[model samples]
Target: MLATVIHAARDIRVEEVPDPELSGSGADAIVRVVAACVCGSDLWPYRGVTPTDAPHRIGHEFVGVVESVGADVEHVKTGDFVIAPFYVCDGTCVNCRNGVSTSCVQGSWWGGSDRSGGFADGGQGERVRVPLADGTLAVVPGPVGDDEIPGLLTLSDVMGTGHHAAVSAGVGPGDSVAVVGDGAVGLCAIIAAKRLGATTIIAMSRHADRQALAREFGATHIVEERGDEGVAAVQDLTGGIGADRVLECVGTKESMDQALRSARPGGMVGFVGVPNGGPELPVRQMFNRNVGVNGGVAPVRGYIDELMDDVRSGAIRPGRVFDLELPLSQAAEAYAGMDERRATKVLLRP
Candidate 1:
């Protein structure tokens, strides 16, 4: 099998690697990847912003067919199409039951060590050994056509993360919302807000292409400014009251500030960015305005079931965020396209 390995900053390669096999707790499963993608978060490591002390397998979002399952795996069978969440967790843990599976006591990340001491291959590969298979892989009940595969793949991460941002902010019917960022997650946030019944959706973006997609995904207004001006733009769109809910999809300090300031006095801000250089909360300002903040690593596993139906129904096409698609062998080029801002997101087919 061939997989992506990041040797260093700006270094990405797809090379032959060992094939994954069933392992761990008699519960692991091997998934033959059909589609995978490059996330904006992956760029941190690719750009060397996040230190990569050693070369490792490096993707997190994928959709595939089950190749085999361990003896203990019960919910899915061989040949089933599945969406694998970025994190692996046992379903019976306290946190898993409470819908925060990311914090499960037995939780492990993709591309890292599995519970059995064998490698858990990253999504950017021909096959992956999915830990906690029953809890981590969501089965698509019926046949999945090639046309719908891209959309289904988004359920593994971006779509779920966007939905988390909306849910954290308490978006509801007739509320006004502002999304801070124009990356894949932010655009998906627009779709999520719309689905949650927000009457006004403001998308803050400086890129023309992303702004267009934001509108297509249900953003009612586009603000091309940044910093204070961006906040003012959002406020102006919402009749000077600011948005009722703000979704911060970028983890930079400036984007966070813009999101916090774009909310109304009593509005809430939901943030799901990976916290690259985000700042500590402005305690005084939040207190003075009665604003609230919530969000973190999205519990994508929990939301997968909730969002899968929408993806199947064509109610939301979050996969549109993937502007480019490449073969797995061209993983390095795919990374470069995203790094250079030439692609919003890239889907790779094995």
Candidate 2:
């Protein structure tokens, strides 16, 4: 089997590796990964800012077909197409039951070694061994074709996170929202804000291409400024007040600060960017203005069912974020294209 291996910083390669050896029979399942992609979170280690002691397997978002399932795995069976949310959760745990699957007591990240189960080298590969199969894998309905792959794939992470951002920011009908950053997650956040009924969606994007996509996704205003200039621009658009809600998709201190300032004094800010060391916030500033902050890694498993219907019905098209696609063999290029900002998002097909 061919899989991605991160040998070092900026060095991602596709090479033949041993197939995943499924363990246990209670809930484990084997999936032939059909589609995978490079995520903004994956870039932390690739850039070496997150630090790595040894060669590590990368990637966590993927969708695939069930090849085999343990005896106890009944919800999904052979030939069922499923989307593997980034985390493997047992669903019965307290956190899972409460719709916070990311913190499931029996859950673990894709490549982590622990309880419920595990996947080898993560999702950017030809195959993966799913832990807690029944609870972790969401079965896609009916017969889905190639055209829907990208959309289905986003349910596993990106789109779900964007939805989380909007929900956390308290975006409601008639509310004016501002989205900071123009990355894939940021663009998806624009679509999500619209889906959630925000009357006016303002995307803070400097890139023409991304701004165009943002508008297409329902952004009513585009603020290409930065710093105080950016905040003033958003305020001007909202009638001398700031946005009612702000979604911060970039984890940098600058982006976070911008988001805090772009929101109305009592507004909320939902931040989902994987903070790679620079997400510090000034408590004094937050307290003085009453900017509410809430967000972390999204509990995608909790929102999959609702978002799936939206995708299946064509009401939302988050998959269009994948502007670049490559075969599994070109995984290195997939990483480079994303790292160089040459692609909004990169999808890999196996």
Candidate 3:
């Protein structure tokens, strides 16, 4: 099987690697990856901001067909078309039961694990093994086609992350909202805020193409400014009170600050950016303003099903984020395109 391996900063290659096997492993499911993508999180390692090894498998967002399943995997079966959200968790855990599956006791992140008993799990490859299949893989409805693959794949990560941001901020009907990034997640946040019944949406996008998509996704206002000017723009549009809710999709210090300041004094800010630089906060100030903040790694597993219904119904087209598509062999170019902002997001067919 062939998979993407990042050897160093700005270095990526698609090469043949040993195929993954089910081996009847504990609750494992082997999937033939039909579609995969390079996430914004992938940039951390690509830019040398996050150090990675010479031959580390990369990527996490994916949709595929189940090739085989372990004996104990009950929900997913062989030949099922499925979407694997970026994280795997044991459904029986306390956090999962409460719907925070991203923090499941037995959680493991795709692309790589963190300190909490998580490690690197591959998502961009010809095939890969998923742990805790019943909890991790959401089987899509039958008869899915190539055209819908991109949208379905978004359920695995970006779309869900955006939805989480909206949900985090408690967006509701008739509320005014602002989104703080122009990347894939930010655009999806616009779509999510619309779906959640936000009547007025302010999209803070700096790019012309992204601003267009933001409007297409239901943003009523496009604020292209940054820093204080950006906050002033939102304030001016909101009659000087700021928006009712703010979705912070970029995980940078300035972006975070912009999001915090762009909200009304009591407004909620939902942030889901995989922080690249250290993003700090004026904790005392936010507290004094009574501004609420919440959001971290999205519990994608908790949102995939609901988002899928919207996709299946043609109510939302989140997959439009993949502006560039390439074969696995062109993985390096895909990375370059995204890094240079030439692509909103890249989709790779393996």
lDDT of each: 0.92, 0.89, 0.89
Expressed as tens digits, the lDDT of each residue in 1-350 for candidate 1 is: 99999999999999999988777568889999999999999999999899999999999999999999999999979999999988888878999999899898888988998666767899999999998899889999989999898889999899999999999999999999999989999999999999999999999888999989999999988888888888788888989978999999989888888888999999999999988865788999999999999999999999988998998889999989989999999999999999999999999999
Candidate 1: pairs in clash: none
Displacement of residue 236 (Cα, Å) in model 3 is 1.0
lDDT minimum window of 10 residues, candidate 1? 112-121
In terms of lDDT, model 2 sits at 0.89
> Whose TM-score is greatest here?
1
As a TM-score, model 2 comes out at: 0.97
- Candidate 2 at 85: error in angstroms? 0.7
TM-score for each predicted model, relative to the true structure = 0.98, 0.97, 0.96
Comparing 1 with 3 on lDDT, the higher-scoring candidate is: 1
**lDDT of model 3 at position 109:** 72
Ranking by TM-score: 1, 2, 3
Backbone clashes in model 2, listed as residue pairs: none
RMSD values, in order shown: 0.9, 1.2, 1.9
